[model samples]
Target chain A: MNRRPTLWLLLSFALVLLLAFACQQFTGAEYFIDSSSCNGCGECIRICPNDAIYYNQSGKAEIDQTKCTHCANCVAICPNNAVY
Target chain B: MLACALQAQNAFTLRSDAQMVIAQSHTGVAGLNRMSWEHHFGPDLDLSVSSTLNSNDRIIPTNVQKLWHNGLVDINYRGTDFTVHADYRNTVFGASQLLGLYPTWDPLTSQKRLMQHQGTIAAEFDADFLQLGGFASGKILRYTPYTLDLDTFELVRQDNANATDVYTGAVIKVPIIKGLATHVAMDYKSGTFADNGEYDLNKLNAGLNADYKILGNASVSASFDWTKRTGAAISNGKTNLLRSTLRLRHRFSNSLAGYLLYINNSCLNDRMKNLRLMANYLRAQVQYSFPSDPTGGSYLLVGGKYSPENKADAYFVEGDYKVREKIYAGGSLNLQPDWQALISARLSYYYTPVNELHLQYSHRQYTPWNNSSLDFGANYLGVGTSFHW
Candidate 1:
C-alpha cells in the first residue's frame, strides 16, 4: 500500500513517453544535386557508402534513388556545394 | 591533325594506390589502379571513360582472396538553364561487409560473388527562382556461386541474393528570401529478388528541407523524412520510418569555425517484437587554423549516440594536427558500452599538391552487446601512397 512508489512509477513512465514523442518530428528533408553547380569532382561518389551516386551522360554526378539509404554522405562530401 | 585536336581537347589521368596491410592472421597486399580519359567537345558538352581494377583480401574476415574490376562511361550536357546527364556502369566484384563505423556482431562472414550493370539518367532545370530536377535509374545484379551438380555431372549456379532495383525521384526547390530556402522531394523505389519473391519490396520516401543563414558567418539547416515500406518479407508486411537532422555551422573568427549536428532515427507503430531501430546521435566539432598558413590547421571533434530501444550508448573523440606544412597526423578514439573500443592513428606526408604518402594503424576491441564471451581484438597497419596528374 505504498501509494508514493506507484505515483513515482507512473510519473516516470509518462516522462519517458513524452520524451519519445518529442523526439519524433516531421522536419526531415530530401537531398538533391544541383547539376549546374556540380563540377564532376567525383568526391561524392567515392564517399557514398551505399554506392548510390554515379555519373550521368553529361558527366555530372547523379544519385540513384533506389540504392540511396538517405545517409547524406554525398551531401557532406560535395566540395562545390552542389548537393542539397 | 585529328589526333592533335583530340589530344588537345582530352585530359588523361592514371592513378595507382597500393597498401600493404598487416593483420593478425595474415599479411595481405591490396591494390587499386584506375585510368580515366575526359574529353570536352565544347564548353557545354563532355564525355568520359574510366576503368578501375581492385584486388583486396583484407576487407572480409576470411582469407579468400578475390580480384575485381569495373568500367564506366559518362556524358553530360550543361545548357544555360537546363542540364542533362547519363551514365552506365558494369562491375564484377566480391561483396562483403567492410570494416565500418558499426562493428559486425556475427562472427561468421562470407563473400558474395556479384556482377552488376547499372544505368542512370537525370535532368535538371533552373527556373531563376525555383529549381526542379528528376532522375531515374535501373540496375541488374547477378549472383555467381556454382556448385557441382551430382545428377547432371556438371556445375550449376546456385540461386542467391540476385535482385533488380529501380528508383525514380523528383525534387523542387524555392528560394523564399535572401538567406532562406526550402525544398520538397519524393522518390519511389522497387526491388525484385530472383531467388525469393517474398523478399521483394517497394519503398516510398518523402522529405522536406529548410535552410537559413542566421548571420554573415553562420547558417542552420534542418530536414525531416518519412519512409513507408511494404513487402511480404517485412515484419507484419509493412513498416514506417521517420528520420530528422538538424545542423548548425558558425565561423567564429577568421581562423576559427565549428559545427554541431544532431540526428534522430525512429520506427513508428512498431509491431515487430524482435527488431527495433531507434537512436539519437549528436556530434560537435571545432576547427582552428593558422591565419598566415593556409595548410596548417587542427580540429577536435566529439560525438555521442544513444539508443533507447537497445539500451546502448557510444562516444567518440577525434582530433588532428598539421604538425608542419608537409607533415600531418591525426588520431581517433571510439568507445561503446560493453567494453567495445576502437583507436586509430594516421600520419601523412604531402610531397606536392596531388601526391601523398601515409601510414595508418588501428586497433579494435569488439564485444557484442548481447554476448560478452565472443570478444575479440584486431590490429591493422597500412602503408599507402597516392599520386595524381
Candidate 2:
C-alpha cells in the first residue's frame, strides 16, 4: 500500500493545528449548541460539571453562557455532534 | 474547547421563564408553579445571577412556597493560567438524602424541604502536567420539619434546628503517562448544631484516585478515601470511615460495551464499637447502541447490583429510542427484591429550532411500613415546554 495518503493526512492535521495556533491571538474558540442538530436527549444536562446547561422549556438543552466554565464536557459527550 | 475564543467583555446573556407542573394520581391532583431568571455579564470577568420562585400545592399533604437565590463570579486573567471564583447560593429544595449525608428514601414523601445558605471561594493554577487548587466553603442548613404550632396556631420556627458546616480543601493532579492521571485531595471540615452543641464535629478527609486508559479503548479507574471525625464537645468520641471504589470499562464491538464496578464503605464509631457498619456492593452493566440513520438510532443499558448488607439484589435497565431527530422516547426501570419497583418514562419533541415540548411519567409501588396488608404507591405525570430567544 502506498504510504503517501497517510503522510498527507498527518501533514494536513499538523497544518490545521499550526493555523489554529497562529490564529489563537486574533479569535478565540467559543462553545455553543447548534439548536438545529440538538436532539433534546438531556444527556448534556446530566453530565455538565458546572450544572451550567439545562433543558429549556422546549425540551432542548441550552448552555448558560455565564455559568459555563468552557469545560467542553457537553461538546465531547453529545452523540449528535450538536454542541460546538 | 478553546479558552481563547474571541468574545466581547461587555456581552450579557439572560434566561427568564415561567413553568407550571401538575401531577395527577388516583387520590387527587397536585400542582406546582415556578418562575426563574438567570443572567450573566462580561466575558473576561464573568458574573452569574440566578433566582427561582416556586409554589406547590399537594407536593406534600399541604401547600408550600419557596424562593432560591444563586450568584457566581469568575475571574480569569488574559494570557495566564490562574483562575478564581466566588459563589453564594440560598436554596430550599426537596431533601433527597437524610442529613445531607446519610442515604435514605424517607424523603420521597411529602414536600420535605432542605434549606441551605452557602458561600464559597476557590482558586486554581493550571500548568502543564500538573494542577493545584484550593477552596473554602461554609453553609448553614435548616432541615427540620416545617410545621404549624398546634397550640399557638402559627408557624413554628425552630430556632435551634440549624446546623453550620465549614470546610476547606485542596487538591493536586498530575498526568503521569499517556492516557493516565493521578490525583490527591485533602479536606478539613467542622460542623456545629444549634440544638445540641455536644454534637459538634471536626473531621479530616484524604483521598486518592487513579485513572488509566487501557488498549486505547478500555479504561480503569480506582478511588480510595479515609475520613476521621471527632465530636468536638465530647471527649473520646470519634468515628472513622473508609471508602473505596473500582471501575473497569471496555468496548466489545462498535456498538456494544460493558463495565463492572465495586464499591465498599465501612465506618467505625468509637461510641458504638460493637455496631461497626460495613456495606459492599458490586454491579455489572452492559450497553448497546444501534447504527445511526436518518430515521434515528437507539441505545440500551442494563445493570444489576448485589448488596451484602441488605441481602438483596437490584436490577436497572434504561433505553432511549430516537424516532428521527425531532422526537425521542426513553424509559428506565429499577427493581429491588426487598422494596418496590420504580418506573419512569419520558418523551421529547422538538417542534422547531428554539421550541421544545416534553412529557414524563413515573410510578413507584411499595408497601407502607405501618400498613403491611395494603400495597401503596405513587404516580406522577408532568408536561413542560421550553422556548428560547
Candidate 3:
C-alpha cells in the first residue's frame, strides 16, 4: 500500500497550513523598546520577568504591551542596545 | 540630589564571553567552543562561569571520537526581598541512540562517553502580596568505558544515574479592581533515582491566576493548572495533569503591540491501564516600532498545534536594527511543517560602554522520516566584554 507516502504527508500538511495563513495575513508580532538607545538604564527594568518593563513619559524604557512575553529577555538584556 | 546619590550607589559588573562555532552537514565539518564569565556585586551578588566545547568532525566515525565538554556555574543572592540561587553543571557528552537523520550518524548510537553532574539550590521570597519559593536539585550520571574501533555499535555497560530533586513553591497576589489581579499557586515535587529505585518521582501542583486590565492599552490573563504524578518508573502508571491558559494583550500605539496565546493539556494514566493524553496550543503575536525610528524593530509570529494524531503550524519573522551608535543588526525567518526553513543573521559591535563584537549566521532545512532533505549550517564568531564600576 503505497498511497504515495500518505499523499506526501497530506501535501506537507497542506503546505504548513498555507504558510501559516500567509503569515497571519500579512504580519504582526510584538516586542519593542528603543527610545533612542534608551538611557533609562532600567536594565530592562531589572530583567523584566513579565513585569514587562516600564519608565515611559520620555524616561524611555517602556514595554508593557500587556506584560511582554516576547521573551528576548529584554532583547538580550539591553545594555543600551535598547530592547528590540 | 543626583537622583539620591544615584539611588544609593553600589554597582559593579564584569562580563566576558568568547565563542567560535562552525557547523556544516553533509557529514562533515564541526567545531564549537564557548566561554563565559560574568560577575556583578551590586544590588546583591552574582557570579557566573561557563564553558562548552564540542568537536569530533563527523563522517562514519573514523577511529571513533564524538566530542563534548561542558561546565557551568552560577551563583546569585539578593537581600531585602530575599532571593538566592546556586547552580553547577558539568557534562562530557556523546550519547546517541539514533533518533534519526544524522542522529549524529547512528550505528547504534556512537559509543559512550557521557558523564553529567548537576547541582542546584534556590530560594525566593518577595512581599508585595506574598510570594515564596524553594528548590533543591542533584544529578549525576556516568557512562564511559566503551571500545569499538571505527564505530559500528557493540560496546555496552553504561549505567550510572543518580537523582535527587525537591521543589516547593508559593505565590499569592490579590488586588482586584483598578487594574485587577489575583494569583494563587502551590507546588511540590520530589524525585529519587539513585541507581533507579524504580525510577522514583513524585509531583503535585496547583495553580490559579487571573489578571485583568482592559483599556488603557489592554491586558488579560487566565490560568488553571493541576497535576499529580507518581512513580513506579512513571510510564503511564500514575499520572494526572490538567492545564489551561489564555492570554491576550493589546496596545495599538506607541509603535503598536499585540499578542494572544492559548493552551490546553490533559493527561491521565493508570487505572488498570487506561492512558490518555491531549494537547492544544495557539499563539499569535505582533510588535512594531519604527515610528520615526525607535532604533528599528519588528516581530511577527504565528503558531498552532493540536494533538491526538498530530497537527502543527508555525511561522516567524524577526528584526532588529540600531545600525547607528555601536552597530547592531538582526534578522530571522522561520517556518515549520517537518521543519523546513530557518534563516538567521546577526551583527554586533559595541566595543566600549562595555565591549562587544559579534557575528552569527544560521541556515537550516529539514524533512526527516527518511524522506531525504536535511541541510544545516551555522557560523558564529564572537567576542564580548563588559566591566562596570
Candidate 4:
C-alpha cells in the first residue's frame, strides 16, 4: 500500500495557496467585467474574499482596485455586466 | 504571502491558446493571454502582479476587447487578530472601440456605449480583528456616439453617464462561538456626474454566518444579512434589504454527494415603481463524482423561483467529465413546467505543450420566462479555454 507522507500533505496545502496568487497566467479569455454596465447589486461584493467593493459617495458600488485580484466574480455575477 | 515565497523558487511557466468557430453561419475567433509574477522582498513585504486581455470579433456584430491589470504589494504586519496590508491598482475600461465597429446593429446603433476611462489608487492601513481603509480615486466616463430617436423622443447614448466616485469603509468581525461569526460594516461615498448632478450615500450592514458539522462528511450552513442604504441624489431615496440563505450538504462517499439550499431576499427598490420586490428560490442538487479523476462530476439540479406576483419552475440533470486531462466536458437536460425541454453540453480543453490540447464544444437550448405567461425556445453554443502559466 502507498500513502502520502505528512510532509507531502503540508506541501499540497502550500501548493493550493500558490495556485491562488501565482497561477493567474491564463490570458486572453473573453472574461473581463465591464464595471460601468453594473447595477449596484452587491452579489460580487459578497463573493469576494478581499472585501474590495465599497460605496463611493454617489451611492453606487465601487471596487477597491488595489484589493481586487481580477478574479472575475464580478463579471460572472453581473447580469448587466457593468463591470468589464 | 506564503504563496509568493513558494513561487519565487520556481520560474518559466509559459502558456497560450487560440480558438475559432463558425456556427449558424456566424464566424467568431477568441484567444487568451494570462501571466503572473510574484516576488518576496523581505520578511514583511511581498508583491504580486496579474493581468488579463480578452478580445472577440463577431462577423457582423458583437466585437469587443476588454483589458485589465491588477497588482498588489502586501505588507504583512503581524497583529493579535488582524493582518495589515497596503495595495495600489490602475484599471482602464473601454468597450466603445469594439461597439464602434458594428454601426448597423440596432441594439447598439442608437444606444450609449462606453468610450474609455481609468481608475487609479494607493492606500495604507492597520488592523487587529478589524479592518479599515482610506484611498483616493479618479474616474472618467465618456459618452458613446448616439443618434436621437425622434419619434420616441428617447435621447439614448446607450447609457450616457460617467462619474468619479470616492469612498471608504471598514469591516469588523466577531466570533460568537465555534464555527459561528458575525460581521458589521459601514461605508460612505460621493459621486460627481458629467451631467451636472451628484450623489452621496451612507450605508450600514450586518451579517452572521454559522456552520454545524453533522457528520464526517455532512454539514449545514446558514447566514442572514441586512442592509440600510440612503441616497441623496437626483431624487432622495432610502431603501432597506434583507437576505438569508440556508444550505445543507452531505457526501455519501468518495464519489457521490448532495446539497439543498433555500434563499429569501426582500428589498425596496425606489425605482421599481415604489413596489417592494420580494424574491424567493429553492435549489437542490445531487451528484456522483468520478473518483481518481479531477475533472468528472455528474449532478442533477432541480430549482424554482417565486416572486410576489409570479412563479417559475425548472429541473435539470447534468454530468461533468474530463474526457482527457486537458479536455473537459459536461452537459445538461432541462425541463420547464410550461415549456419545451432544453438540452445543453460542452467539451473544453486545458492545453499544455507536453500534454494534449484541451477543447470544449457545448450546445444549449434556452427557455424564456414571463411573469404574465411563460413562453420559451432559444439555443446557443459556447466554446472557450483557459491557458496555464
Candidate 5:
C-alpha cells in the first residue's frame, strides 16, 4: 500500500520533465540569424572543428548547433565577431 | 555547409524544416536518415539511406572490404482538400565474422562477405480524425565466406533465406472532453521468417493513448501497447507482450519542470517465464534556456532506471548545452557503484536543412565483479548532408 502511494509521486515527477518543452512554446525566445553583423571572417568556420560553421553566398558565416560538436573551436576562433 | 553559406547566389532549396542526419558506429554500422524530404523534383518525396562499410576480420579477409546499404523513400501530399502519404525504408547489412584466411592463415587470401536486407513500406491517408494505412516489410539474409587456402574459394552457408510481413492498421483521434483527446489504433500483421538458425515470430498489436491538457503547462496521459507473437527461437517461448505507460507533465516555472512517468510490461508464453521480468524507471530532468542576456539554452538531466534482469540497478546523470544555436554538446556520467563508474561526452555541429558533419567520441571502462577491469571505447567521426534540389 505504501508503494502504491509512491506511484502518484512518481507520476507527478514525469509530468515535470515535459513541461519545459511546453513552456518554451509560450516564452518564445525567438532567434533569427542576423547575417548583417557577419564580417566575412572565416574564423568561425575554421574554429568549428565539426564544420558546423558555414558561409552563405554573401560570405556571412552561420552556425547550426545541431551539427556543432560544442568543441568551442568556433567560439575560440572568431576574431572580429561571432554569435552562437 | 558551403552551399548554405552561399545564400545570396543560386543555391538549392534546402528545406529548413526538414531533419536529416548521418551517423556511424565503429561496429561497421552507418546510417543516413531524412525524416521528411522536400525534394527539388517535388515537395512530396522523402529520401533516406543507411549503409555500412565493413573491413578487418569482420566477415572478410585481411584488407578485403564490404559495403552495406539502407535506403528510405516517402511520398506525401496535402492539398487544400486531401492528404495522402507513403513511406518506405530498407536496411541491408553484412553480418559475419571473417574466418581465418586459409588452411595456413594466408595473409594475401581473398575475403568473404555475409549480408542481409530488411525493408518496410507504409501508406496512409488523413481524412477527418481517421487514418488508414497499410504496411509491408521483409528481411532477406545471406552469409558466404571464402578462404584463399592455396586458391580454394569455397561456399560457407548452404541456405540463407528471408521473411516478409504485411500489415494494415486504422487510427482514430477523438476529442473526449474539453481538454482531453484520445487516440486509438489497431494493427493486424502477418509475419514470416526463415533460416533455421534464426528466430521467427508473428504478432499483432493495438495501442491507445489519452492526453489531457490540464491547465496551461500541466497535463497527464496514459498509453498501452499489446502484441502477440508466435513462438520463435529467441522468444524463449514467449508469445505475448503488453506494455503500459502513464505520464504527467508539470511546468512549475520557465526554468524548471517536474515530470513523472511509469511503465509496466509483461510477457507471456506457453508458461509465464519472464512474468516476473518487469522494468520500472524514474527520472527528473531540468531545462534551462541560456539567459537571454547569455547565448543559448542548456538542459541538465539526472535519472534512475531499474530493470529486473540487470545484476543490479544503475543511476545516470547527463547534461546538455545548446548555447549558440550553432554549438551543441552533451555529456553523461553513470555509476553502477561498487561495480563501475563511467562518463561520456558528445559534441555536434548544427547545419541547416538539418544535415551536417558529426564527430563523436566516448569511453567506458568495465569493472569486473572480481575487482579487475577492462577499458572499452568508441569514437565516430563522419560527414552527412541532405539536399532537396
Candidate 6:
C-alpha cells in the first residue's frame, strides 16, 4: 500500500495543531468559591473528578488551585451556586 | 433472511432530551441529543461512531450558558480467548460568559472555550478460571483562559489549566467459589500542566476487590485500595481507603418487596496534611416497595439514608400511580438536615414505548446549620421530553 495518504494526513493534523496553539489566548482570571453561600453539602466535592475541592478548617468547601483543571463541573454541581 | 442479515450488520440509533426549567432565580432551556451508528464487520469485530450535543443555560449561577459537543469512534475485536478495544473522543465546551457578577461579562466579550482529545485502548483475555485485562488511556485538555478585559483582548498570563493526563492499569480476576469472585488491580497515572510544574504529579494505585453472595438474595462486596503520590504537587501523599457494602433483599409476597443496604467508607491512614478530606462516610438505607394499584403501573417506596459522620440524615417517600393507560402521576417528599426539605410532583405522558413527556414541580427549602439568615426557598417548574428511535 502507498504511504503518501497517511503522511499527508499526519502533516495536516500537525498544521492544525500549530495553528490552534498560535491563535489561543490566556488570562489570569480564575474561579473561586463563595464561602458564605456554601452549605458544605459535599456535592461539589463528590462531583470533582480531579479531587481538587476539599473541606477547609471551617468545614466549608475550598478548591485547590493546583489540582483544579477548570472543568467547571463544580460550578454546575453546586446546588447553592457557590462556585464562581 | 436478507433483511435480517442487513439488520444484524448495521444499526443506528438516535436519542434526544429537551427540558425547560423555570426557577425563581432564572429560567432556562436545556437540550441533549445523541446519534450513534454501529457496523459489524463480522461476529467478532465491530465499529461504532457516536456524536452528542448538550447545552444548558443554567449550568452556572445566575444565567450563564454552556454548550458541549462530543464525537467518538470506537472499534472492538474479539477472538477465541482475547478481545481488543480502542476508542477516541474529541469534546468541545463553550461558555457564554465567564462570570455573572462581573461588570464586563457579556455573552460575546467574556466567552470561554475548552477542547479535549482523549484516546483509550484495552485488551482482555479469559482463561476459563480467571481473566486478565489491561488498559491505557490518555487525554489532552486545552482551555481558553479567562480574560480581564474584553475590548483589548490583552493576554497577560499563559494558560495554566491546559494539561495532559496518562493512565494505565491492569487487572486479574479469579473465581474462588460458586458465588464468590476476587480481583486485584494496579494502576499508574501521571499528569502535567502546561505552565505550572508544581501541579505535575505521578500516582500509583493498587487495590483488591471481592464480591460474595449469601444465598440468592443477599450479597456483600468490599474493596481496599492503597494510593501513593509523588512529585512536587501539593497533594503528594499516601492514603489507604477501605469500602464495604452489604445488601439484603427479600420479597415478602407477590406484590411487596424490601431491601436494606449499608455502605461504609473509611480512610485507614491520617497522614495527609494538606487536604481536609472526609475520613469516613457511613450510610444505611432501607427501602420498601409495594404496588399501589392492580394495574401494575404504580408502586410506592419509602427509604431513609442515615449518615453518622455529620448527622446528615435524609428520608424520602415516593410513589407513582397510573391514572390512565398513557398517563401517570408521581410525587415525592424528601427531608434533610437543618430543616431542608424538597417536595416534588410529576405527571408523565407516554406517547409510545420509547417516547415520554413529563411535567414536574418542586419546592426546596435550605437552611444552614449555623446561619438561619442564609435560609432560602426556591420553586422549580420543569417540562421535559425524551424521544428514542
Best by TM-score: 1
Error of 3 at B104 (Å): 32
* Cα distance off (Å), candidate 5, residue B185: 5.8
Q: What ranges in model 5 sit over 4 Å off?
A: A1-84, B1-70, B79-85, B88-95, B98-113, B126-129, B145-208, B225-240, B255-258, B267-277, B281-284, B292-298, B310-330, B334-342, B345-361, B367-389
True contacts kept of 2: 0.00
Which should have the higher lDDT, number 3 or number 4?
3
Calculate each model's fnat, 2 decimals.
0.01, 0.00, 0.00, 0.00, 0.00, 0.05
* Model 1, span B270-291: residue lDDT tens: 3522223355545565666655
lDDT of 1: 0.59
Top model number, DockQ? 1
Provide TM-scores for the models: 0.63, 0.58, 0.24, 0.55, 0.52, 0.62
TM-score of chain A of each: 0.64, 0.64, 0.28, 0.52, 0.49, 0.66
**Comparing candidate 1 with candidate 5, which one achieves the higher DockQ?**
1
How much DockQ does model 1 earn?
0.05
List-wise, what DockQ does each model earn? Answer: 0.05, 0.02, 0.02, 0.03, 0.02, 0.04
Chain B, per-candidate TM-score: 0.70, 0.66, 0.25, 0.61, 0.58, 0.68
* Candidate 4 CAPRI assessment class: incorrect
Q: Once model 1 is optimally superposed onto the true structure by TM-score, how far is the C-alpha of residue B233 displaced, in angstroms?
A: 4.2
| Alpha-carbon RMSD of each model | 11.1, 14.8, 26.0, 13.0, 15.4, 15.4
Candidate 4 lDDT by residue in tens digits, B68-136: 222222233434444444443333333423233122123334323343233334333334344444344
Stretches of candidate 2 off by over 4 Å are A1-84, B1-26, B31-56, B59-79, B93-115, B128-130, B142-162, B172-185, B195-200, B206-208, B232-238, B267-277, B293-297, B308-314, B336-339, B368-375
Q: For residue B294, what is the lDDT in candidate 6?
A: 53
Docking class for candidate 6:
incorrect
Worst 10 residues of 4 chain B by lDDT: B370-379
Where does candidate 3 stray beyond 4 Å? A1-84, B1-142, B145-199, B204-213, B224-288, B292-389
